[model samples]
Target: MITTRDATKNDIDTLFDLILGIAKFHNQEEYVLTNKEEMLNSGFNNEPKFGAIIADFNSKVAGYLSYTWNYSIWNGCEYMNLDDLFVWEEFRGQKVGLMLMEHAKNICKEKNISLIRWEVEKDNVKAIEFYNRLGAKITEKGIFRWHLNASN
Candidate 1:
């Protein structure tokens, strides 16, 4: 059976491995790849700023999700930004993803978050379908990003 629970310090190494697998799967550029040490600092630091959940199946980690809360002026309430949702290749079709999402929903309810948000690559049809199946709608607006450089 698959079960989902919040990730703790003990799951850091396993979560790091899964993150690397996701980074490789997406073929992200080196500059954008997530580093294990940085993740540890951000998630397990004195004042951790992010939260994660792991999907455990028969005592093994099969998938995980990381999220943070964001405020929206338009909504006037806090919403959850699902930063990452990844499942192992072998567990793709097994409901590990669903279990992770359910976990997120529970957190949102507990935290009084108004909504959950995430971005998916345009070409990832499978992911789009999965999100839709989960009752997620694609906003018809574009997302803008600005990268800041230290040299400024």
Candidate 2:
């Protein structure tokens, strides 16, 4: 029996663990600078910077996802930007990812958001297939993209 629910303050440590797992999966572990305390403060605040959900399988924590809302000027509306969707290695084929996504979609619907968006690593074939199965279309990336850090 799998269940999904909004993440609470108590889940901060678990969330941090799951997030680190995801970062490692993507070879981005060094980028996980946010600590558990920071996650608890921002994630559970009255106005959360992002929304998080936990996936449980028979009372055991299986996985988690974090997302935020983004405004699209071309679409003239806000869309749910699924920042991260990850399932534990042991829970991969158990449909935990599907359950997490369905939970996100339901939340989006409730908020009157008709679209959900996210970018997948191009080499993640399994994820691309999964998103394709969910009717997500690929959009081409701009030829030039840049990020601003402390140093130029």
Candidate 3:
């Protein structure tokens, strides 16, 4: 059976491991530099920057969904940005991802959030199909980024 709950500070190590697992799956493990201490501080500090929902299978960590809030200037509305959604390889096809998404949707319902947004790699066809199955529309808009350094 799969269950999910809000992640706490004590789960930081496991969370970090799962994060690394996801990064490795995407072949971007080298890009992950955040340590457990940083994750703990950032997620559990006085002003938390993000929130996570952990999925467990038979009392073991199976997956997680991390999210943050953002506002749309043009729409004058707030939305939840799903930063990460990952399930362990062994846990695939078990509905764990669906459960996490439903959990997120419930959170949005309670918060009156009209939309949920997320980005998936263009090559991740499975992920795109999953999101499409959940009724998410793929926007034609392109994403552009400008990286900045703290020194600047």
lDDT of every model, 2 decimals:
0.86, 0.91, 0.93
Clash-forming residue pairs, model 2: none
If scored against the real structure, what TM-score would every candidate get?
0.90, 0.93, 0.94
By TM-score, the better pick of 1 and 3 is 3
**lDDT for position 37 in model 1:** 78
Task: Give the alpha carbon lDDT tens digit for every residue of 28-144 in model 2.
Answer: 999888998888778888988888999999999999989998999999999999989999898888989999999999999899999999888889999999999989998878545
**What's the count of clashing pairs in each model shown?**
0, 0, 0
- In model 1, pairs of residues that clash are none
Q: Model 1: per-residue lDDT, tens digit, 20-129?
A: 77777898636455566777888887888899999988887899998887899998989999988999888898889999999999999998775999988888898899
**CA lDDT for candidate 2:** 0.91
Model 3 over residues 1-152: C-alpha lDDT tens digits? 99999899998988999899999999999889899888888899999989999999889889999999999998899999999999999999899999999999999999999899999999899999999999999977789987789976
lDDT sort, best first = 3, 2, 1
Which one is best on lDDT?
Answer: 3
